[model samples]
Target: MVKRLGLFVIGFSLIVVIIQVAIPSADGRFEQADATPEKRPFLIVAGLDSLTNGALTHKTKSRYLDTLIPQMHKTYGDGGPGYVPFDSIYFKQDHHQLKMSRRLKEINDLEPGQYPSQYSFDLKGLYTNKGRSDWLRFDLKKDWTYGRVFYLQQPDGGSFKIGYRHQKFIQVDTGGSLSLKTIELPKHVQDRQVVIRHISGKVTLFGGIFLKNGGVAVSRIGQGGDLLRWHAQLNNAFMKQWLQQLKPDLLIFNGGTNDRYRSSVGEFRRHLRHYLKPFEASKCQILINAPNAVKYKQKRLLNFIHSMKAYAKQHNDAFISNQKVLGNTFQEAQQAGYMGDWVHPNHRGTKKIGNQLFFYIREHVLPSYKKEHAGF
Candidate 1:
């Protein structure tokens, strides 16, 4: 009997060792393995609405994107804020680390009798500095190794000086005619702050990008009152160029609150397909998120949700219904204190929704993705 008990103990110890060796760690790495883990940055592009733009939320931290960003960092590592636009009039970006100070003039790309498709580059949101002293300073909180500046070189374009850490500035001349230009930072340079000084002529700034060595990058592209169909208003060439550059791992389409009263089910379907057309060639994962329940126009919202779910199913895309997380009905959500007004959610509601979304992605989405990509 003593000999048998000792043998059993030894067998269990071997099983424990085998289990530890086979299973990957919480950081997505195998134990005692030399094979480098997936270090490539996982980029998530979210095209949402006011819920993500922080228009209805009283506090900046209460925004869903704010909650999602930190949670994603905890798991996938921090890749720094992905994209930072120049204008804050419509879209409220949450890059507290980077600060800009200058009297910049905002320009809309929409031209009379001409759609965005006619434009060769992105002109939707632009900031111009005509003054020689006019400067847009970037104060970064963390040390970043990679950065890029997006701008348009036009006939009236001027020169701008880019300096690192208050050092000597490098002057770039925006060449004549309309075209897109990208300024990439030297890979060896570790940057803390960047300043764009207006040298001469008109310097039109589109936006900027900041990234770390590895991990996940979540870029929030949202406006206060944007609809999915409004993507049509964006320049197709610019859209393709940006997507090719971004090369997102996952693309999330979130909108419907503004369209609930205005769009029909058929129109919404067409709009979603139109928005997704550019991404089909990329072969990246797509996630369609239904908007939260509202007080009025509940039927219209439900119809939109149903259409979105069906479309996602048809296209083999992932879908999450906010109604499931918040409440199935308007009254249910209101009673649960998730609804702030007839159309939007309060701070508490957004926090709850955001946390739930994080959980869902970590638990369900990531597992399926790993399995599909053979432990990617």
Candidate 2:
């Protein structure tokens, strides 16, 4: 009887095991949202200088974007809501091959604040417009938690209250709400991209409030190379240590503007080559962006940049001309009168330039780069 009972139990258990294997789990999510199955190891940003940073951006009022902040979660999977979204603001391609990159790493052994792309690195001055009332909206100003801000004094002398499409608990320099008497903004607006128009065109221009947020973010090292290459000790050890920590996927050499504002051809190429040596060691694709020379100091900078571009192409490595876009914006600036100083943009100018730069990278630059290297 015991043997018979044991046999029955064994058969029943076998049936139960079979039933479980045939049934699927209760949760319906079959694919992971934050993934492509595999991930890249690391990226390094090389060759950063001051003008490479905006020449006159106010550091006190601007927030730097951490491109890695979003990616951090992908590796650890524990940052806020989830992994950092490469956001693909532009990366969309069905096919690509991993070509051997010709980039290099700089400052392998240095200290912090020494590197231009470091989190601590900031612009030289606030290159912003004054006496201008118009403001351009970047991303819809909803859910803005915190960030730096700037404004104009208005022709009539009333305080300019920066406006937002939608927001809450968002604070500026001193944690104060904007004056409702002058500015007007929607309570909850959501714009996938930035858009703007003249307040003179509307009489009631929307106020702008630059807010701060935390996520995977990145910023172009603005234009500061003017004083930086001349002042920054280039390869000081502090700069190298910073690179080790930040390890950016790409470091853009958005310079040659200051270089083009040169006294002679030798001086221009000298500085350009000086940066290249250390940069070659950084292991990042070096994009030698030439400056679309404006009449800086009465110098036709665009022409000089054009010459350097030809030189870059001679090597057949990796350098492209961005002068066209820069030139177009400059022409637009001239037509709009936003080039108030005939140089740096005013509030209206900054927004337009910023959006233009952002879009160029999004549309032109990002498409050429695939998020993954399939053939490698």
Candidate 3:
């Protein structure tokens, strides 16, 4: 009888072990970002503040992003109910509400040693050339979560390294709708002439790109330089870690609206080259969204858009024209009940902007990407 009981217990234990072996692990969760035949490519829109986000709608807070993303998603038959990117609100984080000047200083007060996880990054394809550098490639694996500082060193030797230097960083007024921080570069170094040797600081506006032939520009309040600088800062400590962890396949850039708000375009651009130097190393495609028309003085805005159009043509970088969307113009956009302040479009307008850019990327950019990546 005792031997029979022992045999039964052994048999039951074997069945339990088998059941356990058949069950899958409970902690395995990582969805792939594969390109779908039905879905179009992604279009990342950076620098979305109040004025640039388009106007707000009259009834709901429906802005451009809200309207345009769904419209494009429907047109492509990808996004629908219960399906949204970023796992975040369609229209959230506006830069207009923050105190950029004051809060920026406060953020700059952090200590580098106080945060190491915020500084994890990978520098790839680092090289130099004739009196110039090609910051071939680098990756912010999981470092995007923590807003850290960034710096750009020159080829052939130079200084002016600016970024979230171990502790300090810039703070942007996102108005609670945007997801980027401003990281202004250091003052230009006076060598033979007024040279912008470095552009360092804290920022998190991904998919931004550098210029082709020293073509970028930046405009800080009193940077002394004339041209504009590239606006690519390393994020806060942990913020950078998130970016590093996310590991974007491509990082596009969309700016030119905020570039107009600079004190000097020359020095800004000079310093921008420094910021872009790292991106160029990565061979990342930097998309530059040209300035669109705002209300009041239409011609001036139109002229700037034209200039940006020319810049895109000359450089052959990606360019989206919110200015050309005549129906989506400032007047039409406001009338569409999507203006936040008659200058910037609201959520619906931002979605529209995102949709337009998304289509452009799908139609014009991704086909080449497919061919290049062997039908990926």
Candidate 4:
């Protein structure tokens, strides 16, 4: 009887081992990223704070990140709902259902549209129509749980009347020369149309409309003519104010395209270190992206890219080089009609960059990060 019981126990132990070998760990099949949502949350902080209004609508922002997110999930697994920190900026070129009349300047002076996530709006035109009743009209794309509009007041700035569907109107008095003013949106029962009419002074610039959302939040954070200095200039107080709310576990830094002439290789590395100083206590894993190839400034740009690669290596952080993955020249992209100018790539170029980054993270970054940190 004792011999028979021992044999049965051995057989059961063997079955358990086979089951363990067949099934994946609790985190899921991919060892690339932490699929366990509650453990590690991903956050993408792209573009510049001043450039946040590039894509005003949710749909447009989704277009910018569509390639990256799904591919990220396929490769790294959905790490759950991502977090977006700031929401006071977004701009969509065509708010599909809205109607507009009157001549408005479609200027990309800010060239905010250079970033796929950015939607450069008619700021000067909006500011110019001071006395006109028909300034600008657009239907809200979605019901925002809460919303806000950021505006810049020039020295001559006076006032503007804002109304929602002709229901409620408010006159915002801008004291002359006020740099910036934030208008709090009223809590709405449903999605509605809004109109802006000039009341007094020139509302020279607008940060754009911002809305709240759940799921992966891809933020645009680049400013034209900006180097890495803008990173330190961001509202750190505000960021820390809602750090808990953001709950970010991974922060990806993608810049230096605008910094080709701004810094030498040594300064580039120093600036990167300075930019990262603020987040030292945040405990989020940082990743850096090398700049994409631009037609001019070939040698200086290459030096900057090399510096970024070195920084990523020395610091042991994940680094993805756009120049390496997307090719050394913009010839292919330009031929494909991706270049908007000598410097920036349009939407098509943006999509290609996203795809390349996705594959790199999937094949190289993920596996290495998992081995070092177990998951992130």
Of 1 and 2, the candidate ranking higher by TM-score: 1
In the range 317-358, model 2's lDDT, one tens digit per residue, is: 355443343345456545664443444434444344334444
The clash count for each model shown is: 0, 53, 122, 15
Residue 104 lDDT, candidate 1, scale 0-100: 60
Q: For residues 1-376, could you state the per-residue lDDT of candidate 4 as single tens digits?
A: 0101000000000000000001123454512211122333345544331122233222222123446766765655453323211112223332334333343222223232222112111111133334334355555443333344444444555666665765655566555543344455454446576666654434432333333333333434332334454343333333342233333445556656555665676776666665564444465566676655678776777787777678778777787765564467867556766555565555665567678766765676456556755545
Global lDDT for candidate 1?
Answer: 0.58
- lDDT of model 2, residue 166: 34
Global lDDT scores for all candidate models:
0.58, 0.30, 0.31, 0.44
Model 2: per-residue Cα lDDT at residue 13: 3
Q: Which model, 3 or 4, shows the larger TM-score?
A: 4
How displaced is residue 100 in candidate 4, in Å?
A: 17
Q: By TM-score, rank the candidates, best first.
A: 1, 4, 3, 2
Residue-wise lDDT of candidate 3 within 170-285, one digit each (tens)?
A: 22221232222222322212121111112223221211111111111110011111112222232233233323322222333333343454424444344344433444334445
Best by lDDT: 1
- Identify the superior model by TM-score, candidate 2 or candidate 3: 3
Q: Which stretches of candidate 2 lie over 4 Å from their true place?
A: 1-216, 219-225, 236-245, 256-263, 298-300, 314-323, 326-332, 347-356, 363-376
TM-score, predicted candidate 4 vs. hidden true structure: 0.50
